[model samples]
Target chain A: GSSRPMKQTKESPNVGDVMSRDVVTVFEDIPVEKAAKLIISGSFDHLPVVSRDGRLIGIITAWDISKAVASGKPSRIAEIMTRRVHSVRLDEPIELAARTLDTHSISALPVVDREHKVIGMITSNHLSRLLARRR
Target chain B: GSSRPMKQTKESPNVGDVMSRDVVTVFEDIPVEKAAKLIISGSFDHLPVVSRDGRLIGIITAWDISKAVASGKPSRIAEIMTRRVHSVRLDEPIELAARTLDTHSISALPVVDREHKVIGMITSNHLSRLLARRR
Candidate 1:
């Protein structure tokens, strides 16, 4: 006897299931130059900023880093980090994240919880994994 | 002004010229699961594995993370991360790096120095920047 498929009213993958729950983060207090260095050395497109206790704050990206580098100085990361963050809930539909990335031409989204604390992140590359494995 | 017309000499764009001199990295000591979380949360395609002294050891990717998760505890990240790292020096021609990425179907390459320490990284996205800006 094989017990397998479970019936469900609707089917969808959620951010909690596929989203990367652990995110690379930078302290909001980190120097702008350090943040830029992380983006360059890590090859990460973007990074989330958080409080000491892991509360979500904002995000910084390579473009922002580049700007800081080009500006040369007198620019702090706090001033340049994106405050208008676009986030999704753990239970939100993956499609929501995809749409967010597509609409903004953003490559990633910070995943947050009820307290607005970032839990993970979702990127087009992660979404591509879903496509690569789905039969 | 003919001042810009300069003497004729062979010219080339080297990897160091455009490579992100900054790199995001993980210590080889980090937990494998934590590494996976980093991949997902950071929205990074690949992350360089470094030693305590910042020597380039290997690299882990989203796929590596997934496999580690799938294999469960019996697996160690050191075993899964790509050990046969294909690296390019900072001074290597960009063409060489591009060819390596294309040939291996890898998305990024760790830029190293003569000592084999990761100095930076080059990715398709960075290369895209050149095309996007060049007339």
Candidate 2:
């Protein structure tokens, strides 16, 4: 038998089940100033960058923009995107996803298909709702 | 006329600037069993309770846990927490404090601080890396 009671399973939920389906993204050629405007206007914390083919090549966030502004670097998106991204599969359990959030200390995870195409975005808020509901 | 350069201004930010300060509150008494555990987990969404504090009497988050779980809810943190919280002056400015999370929907903001309290948190993560070396 398993360690925990089979019926009383799960404490937190999964990224796929909780992440936000509405994600805002940008292209590679966009200027940093323009990207910053999009982040502020769209009221988004992060922006995913996609190639003309719709492949998620990198991710950008408002924080990155702040850093760019403070660093006085190139005012372009491509100049500061995180090519390395931590992502999750849609079907994974919430418990597993929570671990990813904690272990990585990240606020959001981009959910993707097996082909690595972006489907949705999961965040801490999504997880909190699931917890509140079961209560 | 108002303050720093109309454009070259703002440093820290606002509550609307960066606040995961995700309000993940619970009911008056939900046994605290499932609730506490739920917070430990959950991938997203801050299960907003109705009647039920739905009127917005209170808002809770995962951090409340280490507190509640440690204090023992039902046995809950409501029993020991300050009840009095420190919220932000939203619609302020990013240069306000590096101010909120400085992460995901602008690191996430509730956009309403006039309810008295419980708008959003805006953790430190939302603010860091935004300060990453621009080089």
Listed per candidate, the RMSD to the true structure in angstroms reads 16.6, 20.7
In model 1 chain B, where is the ten-residue run with the lowest total lDDT? B1-10
Report how far residue B126 has shifted in candidate 2, in Å: 12
Interface RMSD of 2: 21.1
Best by lDDT: 1
Worst 10 residues of 2 chain B by lDDT: B1-10
After TM-score superposition, the amount by which residue B123's alpha carbon in candidate 1 deviates from its true location, in angstroms, is: 12
What's the C-alpha lDDT at position B54 in model 2? 43
Tens-digit lDDT string for candidate 1 (B1-135) = 223321211244778997887678887767665665565455455789988888888897754543332333323467777878899998787667766765675657999888788899877555434322321
Q: Residue pairs in steric clash, candidate 1?
A: A40-B22, A40-B23, A41-B22, A41-B23, A41-B24, A42-B23, A42-B24
* lDDT of model 2, residue B8: 16
Q: Write the per-residue lDDT of candidate 2 for residues A1-135, one digit (tens) a residue.
A: 123232212232445646778787778788776676666565555678877766678887655554453344475688888888877888887555556666666666778777777888766545544322321
lDDT value, residue B50 of candidate 1: 84
The DockQ figures for the candidates are 0.02, 0.03
Name model 1 segments beyond 4 Å from true: A1-11, A40-43, B1-135
Write down the DockQ of candidate 1. 0.02
